[model samples]
Target: MTRLERKCPICGKPRAAEHTPFCSKRCRDRDLLQWLEDGYALPGPPSFPDNPQDD
Candidate 1:
């Protein structure tokens, strides 16, 4: 059986062993920056305040 090729999520380039899911340091860092700056997010319900007056 042939092995499936892994690709970088940040770019379409083939993944590097060192970076695993990313091709290079640049792509890895870029992904991290995206998370840090809230460029990525998870779906969730609206948060409610413990106290209505807090709003």
Candidate 2:
């Protein structure tokens, strides 16, 4: 494998030039969907509003 070529992030198949890092459109779409659905999360402290809402 070349320096740029690697297994797909989602399926472990050889990645395609058209879809770098992913093997196919299906894998690419799956990754996007995961982002859209909040399936991927960044590690951080819980966020709170600057102004506390008094109930």
Candidate 3:
């Protein structure tokens, strides 16, 4: 029996041999581009004012 991991990091689909942790090359590339473009970000020091009215 082959173990299958049913989660793709890119599109959240079943994992495929062609893309390992991603569903397809397209999805994999999408994730890569997001990383390169700074689209994927982490919560850092608050840059916005605590109150919406302040802005």
Residue pairs with backbone overlap in model 3? none
Error of 2 at 39 (Å): 0.5
Best-to-worst TM-score order:
2, 1, 3
lDDT of 1 by residue, 3-35 (tens): 238678899888888887799999999999999
lDDT score of model 2?
A: 0.87
Could you say which candidate leads in lDDT? 2
Question: Which sections of candidate 2 miss by over 4 Å?
Answer: 1-5, 48-55
Superposed on all Cα atoms, the candidates' RMSDs to the truth, in angstroms, are: 3.4, 3.4, 5.7
Model 2 clashing residue pairs (backbone): none
- Candidate 2's clash total is 0
Residue pairs whose backbone atoms clash in candidate 1: none
What digit string (tens of lDDT, one per residue) describes model 3 on residues 1-55?
2449578876677888888878899998999999999898888877776897966
Each candidate's number of clashing pairs is: 0, 0, 0
